[model samples]
Every structure is written in C-alpha cells, then in structure tokens.
Target chain A: MAFKAGVITFPGSNCDRDMAVALEAVSGEKAIRIWHGDADLPDGLDFIALPGGFSYGDYLRSGAMAANSPIMRAVVAAADRGVPVLGVCNGFQVLTESGLLPGALMRNAGQTFVCRTVPLSVENASSLFTQSFAQGETVRVPVAHHDGNYFADEATLDTLEGEGRVAFRYAEPVNGSRRDIAGILSENGRVLGMMPHPERAIAPAAHPSLGGEDGKRLFESVIGSLVSA
Target chain B: MKVRILVRLKPGVLDPQGRAVHHSLEGMGFDGVDDVRIGRMIEMDVADDTTDEALNTMCEKLLANMVIEDFAIEKLDNEKAPA
Candidate 1:
C-alpha cells in the first residue's frame, strides 16, 4: 500500500511546499495539501505534517491564530484518533498552542531570530520520529525561529522527562529552550514537535554546507513505522 | 460589561524581552530597578448578562495559555449619567 500523508498549508506558510516535496521523496507518494480553511481532512491518512512558517503573520502570538483555524480542529481530532502528526518550527508552536503538546514557545532568550543548522542529540530514539537514530547520536538540522524557547511549569517538565517524551535535545544552547529541548513527543509518541526544519535538511543538493542528509532519517522513520503497521 | 484581562508569564519563566527592557532602563541611568516583567492586557465589551464562568472559559481556551501564563479578569462598571 502507498503511504498517505497530508501537509497543512496555513496562510503565510512558506515551508509547506518543501514539506510536501520531502514527504514525496521519501514515501514515493504525493502528499495531499490541505488548507487552513478546510473543516475536514482526507480519509485514511497515515501521517500529517504541519510545515514551518509565520502562519497568520504571527499575530496575537506565534501559531496562536492558526491553532484555532478550521483545519486545526480536524488535525486535533485526527491526532486524537492515533494518526501520527509531525510539527516543525512554527508548527511546533501550533501544537503547543492547540494543547496537543505541553509548554509554550516563548521569545528566544537572546531576543533575536536564529536561523542556522545546529547539532541535536537524539534523546529518545525509540519514538516514531527518531527510531532510525541511535540514542545520544548527534545530527545537524536547520532551525529558524524567534519564539522557540520552550517553557512549562517545573512539574510538567519533570513529568515529560520522566515519561521519556523528550525526543531531542540541543547539544548547545541554540534558543534558550528549557533543558535545551529541541524536540518532544506526545504521551503516546504519535505526535512530534520540533523547532528544527528537517524538511529543509533532507536534500544534500539543497544544503551542501550542512551536508543535508541527516534529517532524512526522521521522514524515513515515520514512513517505516507506517509501512510496518 | 467591560472586561479587562491581564496575561502575564508565571514567575520563574524566563522573560528575555523584559530583561532587555530592564537593561535599557539601566543604561539610561535609572536605578533601583529590582526587576522587570512584561505582560499583555486585553479589554473587551460583552453583554451584561455574560456569566463569570463564560469569561473564565474564554481565558482558559484562548486568551491565556495555562502552561506558561496566568490571566486575571476584571469587570469595569460603565459610567453613569449625571442627574
């Protein structure tokens, strides 16, 4: 069976195309593009990707407006139904704002937009998104955002840590994120949110300086999981 | 009814923007600035019959992210005409 995936495109979403292309390149199936205004998602989707961008012009709050859009309601419903969801960059903000994930992405402690590839340590390689990587293995991925500092109460943070939900942590302080968390997974590990743009790092030809193939394992992991399931 | 909602980051959460503002104040020779924190205020007009529960729901749902911020709601009385 062909792997089915959907990538949501909110207004001002610049990385939606890249996400779609990356999905197609990995899964050998064209990804369905869904709009923010759509109230329903296509049937039988194996995965959903929320691409990075300044959705709704970052109004009110980063990803706050987009989280309440019609498609997000469907996305939330689909997530609850056990479909794997991947949120990158601004999409990570949306997942937090939508309450699918814990914590909030505050302005970077440096109070500036950071755009570059950074080293990330795979903290939980057992999760669906990081299954291809070995625990504690370092990979370089591109991150571009102003509000990627993750904040949650100490209790919640402790809970997340205890549950082994932290999927990735930065090797160096890149965005003032709590405990240098670069990515996290939901309780059931079906949803993953990260500030790094794995889609941007999937093709070596696109980012030769970054030696851009390390991120392909993430997409491959999701595809592999879906195929096996 | 006039409703004012104040949203603020919880204590212990890092406030980089607030820290920058504090540094600017210090650069301007302002002293005794123990600390600084930034927050947002939202004002809205609603029907007089709106219940407190409704206002709380709004804050919990969208106006405030319970994870890192707290919200306080204040109801302001309308001005009365002089007799």
Candidate 2:
C-alpha cells in the first residue's frame, strides 16, 4: 500500500502547498489537503503535518487562535491515537498552544525576527524524525520566525532531557531556546515539533553550500520505518 | 451594557511589543521612563443581564490565552459608551 500523508491548511497557512509537495516528493503519494474548518482528518492516514504560517493572522498570540480552530480537535485526537504528527515552525507554536507539546515559543530574546539557516545537532536519533542523523550530528536547516524562543520551566526542561524527548538542539544560539533546544518529540515518539523548515531541504540544490541530501533521509526514515512495521 | 476587557501578559513573560514601544518613546525625547508594558483592551456590547461568569468565560476561552495572558472584565452603564 502507498504511504498516505496529510497536510493541514488553516486559513492563513502559506506553507501547506510546500508541505504537500515535499511529502509527495518524499513519500511518492499525493498528500491529502485537509482544511482547518473541517472537523475530521482524512481516513487511513499514514502521517499528518501541520505546516507553518501566520494562522489567524497571529492574533491573540501566534498560534493561540488556530489552536482552538475546529479542525484541531480532530488533529489532537489523531495525535492521541499515535499517528505520526510533525509540526514545523508556526505549526510548532500551534502544537504547544493546543497542549500537544510542552513549553512555549516566545519572542526572540534579541527582540528581532530571526530568519537564517541554522545548524542543528541531532540530540535523540532514536525518534522517528531524527533517525536519519547520527546522534550528535549537525545539520543545517532554515529557521524563520518572530517567536522562536522556546521557554519552559526548569522542571519541564529536566523532564524533557531526562526522558530523552529532545530530538534536536541548536549548535549555536540562534534563538534563546531553553538549553538551545530546537526540536522535541512526544512521549511516545510519534509526534515531533520543530521551528526549522525541513521541507526546504528536499533537493540537493536546496542547500547552497552543503548540497547534501540530508533531509531526504528524514522522510525516508519515517516512511521506511512505517512500512517495515 | 458595555463591557471592557483588559488583557495583560502574565508576569515573567517577556513583552516585546511593549519594549519596542518603549524604545520608540525614548527616541521621541521621553526620558526617565521607568518601564513599559503593553496590554489590549476589548470592548463589546451585551445584554444587561449578562453575568460576570459569562464574561469571564469569554475571556478565558477566546479573548485571552490563559497560558500567557490574564484578562479582567468590567461592565459599564449604557450611557458610558465613550460618548
């Protein structure tokens, strides 16, 4: 059977098409486009992606409004059912706002929008998303956000690290994320949230200098692992 | 009835918008400004019988993000609707 991936498009979602194209290019199956107002996700989905964009025009906080959208109820339910869910950039904000992930992405400590390619080290390669990278390996991904600073209390930070839930960390300080955390995985490792845009790395030419197809391995790892299971 | 809602960022949370405005004020020759914090005010019209609980629910559910914002509700008499 073909791997079926779904990408959600909220009203202001700008990356839904990019996410869908990337998913199809990587998985060889057309990605199902789900609308935010809908109350249900497509059936028999292999994976779900919440793409990044200015959902609800970033009102009442970046993702606060979108988190309460009608479709999010279904997304939360799917997440609970162990469906592999990936939230990128603003999607990460939505996930945290919806209580799917821990902590919050606040304004950048430097008080400016951060838009640049950042080096990230794989912290836990055991998760479904990071299996492509050797543990401690550094990969470059572009991050663009006004509120990418990750904040959580010390205890929550300790829990995430002790439980091996941190999937990626910044090799250098791009945003003031707690302990330089860049990505994280859910307790069951079925959900991953990150501020960097991995979909931008689909092509070898995507990276101007590195020119290495590092991100292709991420999609391959997830789909291949699912197929084998 | 007229209702006014004040939404504020929770303590310990950084307010970048507020800080930016503060910087702008300093640039305008306003010195000695101790601090600046930004908040939102939302005004709405409701029935006279609207209880405080209902207004609180509206704030909790939509007007404010409890994680980062706290909201207070005040009802003003109809004649006080900003002239």
Candidate 3:
C-alpha cells in the first residue's frame, strides 16, 4: 500500500513545497496539501507534516498565532489518535504553543539567527521519527531559526529524559537549547518536533560534507513503518 | 486609563542582547552601570471601566511569554491619578 502523507500550509509558510517534494520523493506518494483555514483533514493520512516558516508573520509571538489556527485543532486531534506528526522549526514552535509539546522555543542565547548544518546525536532510536538513527550516532541537518532555543523547567526536562522522549540532541551548542536538545518526541512517540530542516536535507547535494543521506532515512522509516502497519 | 506592561527576561536566563548593550555602554565610558538587562514595555490606553483582571488576562495571553519572561502591569494613568 502506498503511504499517504499530509502537509499543512499556513499563510506565510515558505517551506511547504519543499516538504511536500521530500515526502513525495521518499514515499513515491504525492503529499496532500492542507490549508490552515480548513477544519477537516484528508482521511487515511499515514503521517502529517508542519513545515517551517514565519507563520502568521510571527505576530504576538513566533508560532503563537498559527497554533490557534483552525486547522491545528484537527492536527491536535490526529496526534491524539496516534497518527504520526512531524513539526519542523516554526512548526516546533507551533507545537509548543499549541500545548502538544512540553516547552517553548525562545530566542537564541547568541541573539542571532543561526543557519547551518549542525551535528545531532540520536537520543532515542525507538520513536518512529528517529528509528532510522542509531543511538549516539551523529547526523547532519541544517537548522535555521531565530527562536530555536528550547526551554523547559527542570522537572519537566527530567521527566522527558527519563521517559526517553528526547529524540535528538545537538552534538554541540547550536541554539542554546536546554541540555542541547535538538528534537523531541511525544510521550507515545508519534509526534516529533525539531528545529532542523530535514526536508531541506533530503537530497544528497543539500549537504556536501559528511556525504549525508541521513535525513532520507527519517522519511523512509516513517513511510515504511506506516506501510507495514 | 493607560496601562504599561513591562516584559523582562527571567533571571538566570542568558541575555546576549543585554550583554552586548552592556559592553557598548561600558565602551562609551559610563561608570557605575553595574549591569544591564533588556526588556520591552507595552503601553496601551484602555477605557476607565477596564478591570485589572482584564489587563492580567491580556498579559497572560499575549503580552508576555511566561516561560522565559515575566511581566508586570502598571497603571500609568488612572481616573483619580494625575492627567
């Protein structure tokens, strides 16, 4: 069975096309583009993606306005139903603002927009999102964002780490994220929120160094697992 | 009534912007500056009938991000206060 994936597009979303293309290339299935205003989602969606961009012009706060958009209600419901969801960059901020994720992404400690391919270590390989990676293995992906610094209280951080909900950790200080957290998974491991742009790195040419094809495995793993399920 | 909301980063959190500004101030030869921190002030004019609860609600909802920042609401000009 061909896997069906859905990509959500907000008004200011610039990476929606790239995300759709990456999903299509990896799964051989055309991605269903969903608008932010709609309340319903396409049926039989194996996965959902929230692409990175300055949604709602970063008004009030980054991702704060988009998190309250109409379509996000459906996205939240789908996530609660165990359908896999991936949120990248601004999408991660949206997830946090929507209360799907534990904490908020703050401005970088460097107070500068960071854009580069940084090394990330796989923290939990059991999640559907990070199953393609080996624990402690470093992978390269480009991260671009001003508010990517992840912040959570100490107790919440401890809980996330103890529950193996942490999906990825920065190999080095990339955005001043707490504990160098680069990616996080929902308690059920169905929802993933990360700052790096994996869709941008789907092609081998996206990152010349490290001869990286690591990002392709992420899409492949989800699609392959969905097909088998 | 005019309400002023001061939103500031929580203590212990790194403030690179504040640090940069501090460095610049020191370079300009300002003494006894001690330290510097950056914050934003949102001033709004609301009707006299607006209650404090309403103002707090606005601060909680959008005027501040409670995670890394703290916000204090000040009643700048009230009906009984100076014009």
Question: Please, what are the lDDT tens digits per residue for candidate 1 over residues B1-83?
Answer: 88888999888878899999999999999999989999999988889999999999999888888888889998887763111
Model 1 interface CAPRI class: medium
Q: For model 1, report the TM-score of its A chain.
A: 0.98
- Candidate 1 lDDT over A1-229, as tens digits, reads 7899999999989999999998999999999999999999999999999999999899878998899999999999999999999999999999999999999999999999999899999999998888999999999999999999988877888988999999999999998998999898999999999999999878776436664878889999999988887
Residue A142 miss distance in model 1 (angstroms): 0.2
| Candidate with maximal DockQ | 1
Write candidate 2's Cα lDDT for A1-229 as tens digits: 6898989998888888988888888778899999999998888988999999999889877888888998899999999999999999989999988889988888887788888778889899888887778998988887889888888878889999999999989999987888999988888999899998888767776437643456666787788877677
- The list of candidate 3 runs beyond 4 A from truth reads B45-51, B76-83
DockQ of each: 0.74, 0.43, 0.53
Q: Which candidate comes out best when scored by lDDT?
A: 1
Q: Give TM per candidate.
A: 0.95, 0.91, 0.90
- How far out, in Å, is residue A210 in model 2? 8.6
Candidate lDDT scores, in order, read 0.91, 0.86, 0.87
What stretches of model 1 exceed 4 Å from their correct place? Answer: A206-211, B80-83
lDDT-superior candidate, 2 or 3: 3
Off by over 4 Å in 2: A206-212
